[model samples]
Target: MQFDLAVIGGGVNGAGIARDAAGRGARVLLLEAGDLAQGTSSASTKLVHGGLRYLEHYEFALVRESLTEREALWAIAPHIIHPLRFVLPHVKGLRPRWLLRLGLFLYDHIGGRKHLPATRSINLHRHPAGAPLKGEFGPAFEYSDGWVDDARLVVLNALDAVAHGAEVHPRTPLTAARRVDGGWELETPHGRFTAAALVNAAGPAVLKVDGLLGEAPEYGMRLVRGSHIVVRKLFDHPYAYFFQLADGRIFFAIPYERDFTLIGTTDRDHTVGEPIVASEEEIAYLCEGASNYFKTPITPADVVWTYSGVRPLVDDGSGKPESATRGYRLDLSDKDAGAPLLSVYGGKITTYRHLAEEAVDLMAARLPALTGKAWTRSRPLPGGDFPLDGLEPLKATLTARYPFLDAGTVDRIARAYGTRAERWLNGAEGWQALGKSFGAGLTAAEVDFLRQEEWAASAEDILWRRTKLGLRLSAAEQKALADYLGG
Candidate 1:
């Protein structure tokens, strides 16, 4: 097949670029080695924030860009994204109270704040968020950020790309690519294709893809593995936390899946081929860190689930992994180098849309078919056309329409599928109409919809990536699901 652009990667960045380019009139093809977002995109801290800790690294431009995109992303994908308040308690010795105030001051003002509330000082002694914390923690700072269903965000972008006439192959890996007389020739497991331009967004495998094209690595990459642990609910309040350690590191404790507390993110240098599972030491470190703040002590045995993702960060010679910059760079091949080649390196989820926009903007000059104007910023992704504050009302509508579904199921459906929930619910009057129950409100009808609409072929794709039901599904139930998928 021939195309104007061929994007190799199905993470958020590649998917976002496909959506933008296809919408702007390019014949686009997106190829992924596995399921969409099976890599770093799915395994994120799941926050859409301005990176408060990055300010300490003096990444003002990156932080400012992220802060600016914060609300814009929330506005476009309100169903899967929503406002979250973070409580940063003051530690007596670490980062003085005044510095925290100044950092937050810049955080609120520099980002063009609008609908979200401003940061405020809080008395942990009187606040509900303080109830589970240690008594020594007195004053705290509450700031605004956002939460996201990271995997779902990637899927939604891919769906929109398809809606705009982009061809997306989830399991097809790009095996080879070479520059030719006016464009580029690409080889994949499925078939051979040609394009006028190519984008390498292979995340941690970026340098490997460059090797496939016989190109030298233009920038250094620091692979930092961030590990997180999920445990039973530690606090009853809705507020999440941002905590600091004497070691000059920071982590977050966020409310997750309604029944669990998500604590995480350790920064350790990681080699490319090493396993991505959270190590016992990393889990114990996070558990012990949470213990120091919460009244209840957390231990490794308390962890119900653990995950880790390697960040492909630009190497700036920072001694510490956490100090590395989150900024991204786009490099286009010189005109004498034949067809255009754009390679993306080092970016975070919060700034993906802007990164995609810049990438398309760079490719537009080389490919004339990319003549249309930029339009992703104002356009909502699939199933995200409602008002920014309309999530509650959307949930109410789902409850009223599908009264047979329990409250938990209704909430899950509303959040996961948004306006598209009705597409599968299809006015089913009872649970039996939805077909066999697989535990945790999953049904044959929902699974069929996922397999048909989304690219879900296995139980892991449906349970872990499409939904977090893997945490609730039992071993027997999971086996049954796997058997049902014929895996």
Candidate 2:
């Protein structure tokens, strides 16, 4: 189909841009090579923070923008985003307490943190979160950030884009594209499409997508692999930990999926062709990093699941992977020559929305057809129409309405779909109405909703991205899901 805008990736940036542009009255088309968020978007550290550590590298602009987005995102997607308290324990040889205090003071004041609490000093000996930490670490700093279901965030954006009259195509790769005088002729396996503007948001393959048009940008990209591991619950509290390593890098240990703790994120240079696997060394590194602070030591053997994602950071001559900037830049391809091609480079998950706003603003300036003002700031994604603090009350209402479903199931569904969960339920009278049980509370009704509404195609997309049911499903259950979806 012909359109005013064609987004090349289904990750957060592409999805966010499509949603924003379409909402502003542009005819937009979003194309994904695989399922939405099947790459870096889903495999994030799953946070909506302002990059507190970025202060060390003097990225005040990025940190300030990200800080603002923390609350904006939580405000828009409360079901999938919520405030989180982080404990940054004060170690002896590491960053000094005064420096930590000063950094946190800036972190609090940098962005307007209204709903979330401000930073405070915590006595580890008395705090409940300290029970799991070693005695050597004490008097930690507590700060406010936000947590997110990264994959769901992207899906919700895509859903909202579609709702705003944008055409979203998953698993449709752009095989070739030829730049017209004032538009683009894109060839895909499905069909040929034309657009007045093209957005190169292919996360790790941003450069590759640009090359499809027979040119590359003036900038460079550094592919850094970050890995995370999931282990049995290490602590029994709602608080998450930010641990500093001796090598000057930092990682986090956060609660995950109610039954486990998610520990992660090592930054190292990785080649393009390499598989996205949590290497033995990386797994061991994360385990060691966590064990240094937690009273109960951890090992690679204790890891139940591990995931890895490569960050396509802009190469700014930083010597170490951790020093690369998380900020994004919009490169408009020689607009004076022809229709504009906006290539997004080097962005973090926390700043996707802001990047999208900037990208679209640039697009509007370059392309006359995309005449629209900045929106999406106050617009909520699909299912995110409720108040910021309405999740618990919404859950209560859902439970009261559907008493037949267990509390856990209701809560899971509510968190996943927010106010829109009712759309999936459709006032079902009882469990039987949900249809064929695939185990782990996954039913045929839910599967049908995923397939029909959320662009879910395979068991992996349903289990891993759309929901984290893969952790709860057994081998047989997963196979059953795959077989059912296959048939």
Candidate 3:
């Protein structure tokens, strides 16, 4: 195959760049080594926020950019991105309440926060969120962020890229690439392809990809491992908690899957390897961190699931892993000569759209074929063509239209696929028409949709990345679904 641009990696950054470039009239080919979002993209804290903590690091530009994109992302993909309130209890011995207030003040005003509510003080004893907290926690501050289906966000980007004429190839890793006279020849398992320009957005393995050309950059990347643990629901309320530790680190206890609480994120350097799993120490640290705030203590046994991802962060010479910057840098090799190669560095999920736009803008200067202007700022991803406030109404419409489906199933499908749910249902008049249910409202029809459309190749892709049905399905049922998909 031949294309105008071949984008490496299928994480958010790579997928986003492919989508933007393809939409701008560039014939794009996106290749991924595994299922989409099988890396750091899927293992994020799943919060779309301005990074209130980043203010402490004096990353005003990053904070502003992220705060700006937070709303823009929600506006475009409202089904997967929804407003969430974060409760920060003013624990003594940590950063003082005054610093917290000032940081929040900057957070509220920095990026032009309009629709989301501003920060306000609340008495922990009186607030519903405090019901799960310890007695000593008195006053707390509540601020707005957002919850996201991180993995789904990636798949949706790839879907939109395909919709816009890009060829997306998951499970196909780029084996090698050599710069030719006018373009480059790239190798994958399937076949060889040529492209006028190349993009290396390989999340954690970006540096490795850059090394393939026998050229090395001066700067290095720090592989920081962040891990999360999920347990039975810790609270009944909708608000998520931002608990501060005595060591000056912070973690979150957010409601997950309606029946569990999600807590995580330790910042330790990690050696990249296959099957990144959370260490026992990391799990214990997270449990202890949450136990310090919640009235009820937590243990490792309570954890139903754990996930870890290695972040390829720019090595800014920060002494601590958590202190590293999340901002990205776009490096263009052969900018003034030869075929252009753009390699993307560290970036956060919140700023992926801006990153992609900037990447394409940089590449457009070199690629004469890329004539289209910036347009993704307003274009909605696949299934995200509806209004931001229309999620519930759309859900109601789906329930009404598919009267045979239970309300819960309708809501789940509506949230996952948005208006595109209709496309998947495709005039299925009844449950039987939808095919057999493999538990958790997952049916043969939906599995077919995933395989045919979303590049889902395995049960792990469906249960863990495409949806969190893994948390709800039994081991036997999950195996059955896997068997069904294999057949």
Candidate 4:
């Protein structure tokens, strides 16, 4: 296939770029080596906020850009993204109270605060979030951020790209690419194609792709692996946590799926090709960290599930992985050096849309066919047309229409598909009409919709990426789902 732009990854950056380019009238092709978001994009801390700790490092621009984009993203994809309050308790020994207050003040003011509430001082002993914490934890600060269904965000961006005439092919790896007379020639497992421009958004594998293109390395990468653990709910309240360890590292413990609490993120330096599983040491570190604050002790045995992903951070010579900058760099090939090739390095999920917009803008300068201006900033992704505060109403509507679905199922569907839930639920009058049940509210009809529309082909793609039902589905149920897909 020949196109105006070809994006070479299906993670959030590539998907967002494809969506933006295609929306602006460019013919776009998106190729992914694995299922969409099967890598770093899905394995995020899953919070959309300004990195408050970054203030100490003086990453003011990055934090400001991320903070500015936080609510903008929520406005467009309110279904998968919503406001989340974080409780940052002040420990007497670490990060003094006045310093915390100053940081919070800057965090509230610098980002063009509009709708989300401002930070407030609270007594941990008096607050509902304090009930599960140790008695020693007294004063705390409640601040605003947002939570995201990380994997689903990638899928939705891909879907929106397809809606705008972009061809998205998951599981198709790029084999080769060479600059040609007018543009570039590309090879993949499926076939060969040509394009006016090429984009390398391969996350951690970006350096490998650059080597394939025979371009000298322009930047060093620090592959920092961040791991998270899911356990039974730690607290009954809706507030999440931002805990600072004495070792100068921080992690979060948040309310996860209705039945679980999600805690994470250990920042350890990772070598390329290393297994991206949470190490026993890392898991213990997190458990010990959580136990320091929570009244109940946490251990590896309490961990129901663990996930890890590497952040392809630009090597800025930081002393620790946690101190590495979350900022991004865009390297566009020289104009006289043949066809334009853009390589993306070091970005976070919270600023993907901004990164994509900037990427497409760079490409537009090289390829005139990319004439359309930036439109993703305000436009909603697929199934995200409702207002920012409209989730409860949307859920109520789904419950009223599909009375047979339990509250858990209704909330899941409404959040996963938003206004698009009806696309699968339209004609089913009852559970029987929705086809066979595969446990945990996953019906055959819903599976079919995912397969037909969202490029889902396997059980892992369905249970894990398309939805997080893997957390709840059993071995037998997952096998049944696989068997059903195979048959």
Clash statistics: count for each candidate: 0, 0, 0, 0
Question: How many steric clashes does model 2 contain?
Answer: 0
- Candidate 4 segments whose C-alpha is farther than 4 A from its true place: none
Q: Mind giving the per-residue lDDT tens digits that candidate 1 earns over 376-432?
A: 998998888899988899999988888888888888888888898888999999999
lDDT of 4 at 253: 95
Clash pairs detected, candidate 4:
none
Which 10-residue window of candidate 4 scores lowest in summed lDDT?
212-221
lDDT of each: 0.93, 0.92, 0.91, 0.93
**Candidate 1 positional error at 422, Å:** 1.1
Please identify which of the two predictions, 1 or 2, would achieve the higher lDDT against the true structure.
1
Q: What are the runs in model 3 whose C-alpha is more than 4 Å off? A: none
Model 4 Cα shift for residue 424 (angstroms): 0.5
Q: List the residue pairs that clash in candidate 2.
A: none
The alpha-carbon root-mean-square deviation between model 1 and the true structure, to one decimal in Å, is 0.8
Q: Between candidates 1 and 3, which one is better according to TM-score? A: 1
lDDT tens digits, residue span 199-299, model 2:
99998999899899776775799999999999999988999998899999999999999889999898989898999989999999999999899889999
Per-residue accuracy of model 4 over 1-487 as CA lDDT, tens digit each: 6799999999999999999999988999999999999999999989998999999999999999999999999999999998999999999889999999999999999998899999999999999999999999999999999999999999999999999999999999999999987788989988988899999999999999999988876899999999999999988889999999999889999989899999989999999879999999999999999999999999999999999999999999999999999999999999888888999999999999999999999999899888888999899988899998899999998888889999999999988999999999975789999998999999999999999999999999998789989999999999999999994
Candidate 2: lDDT of 264?
A: 88
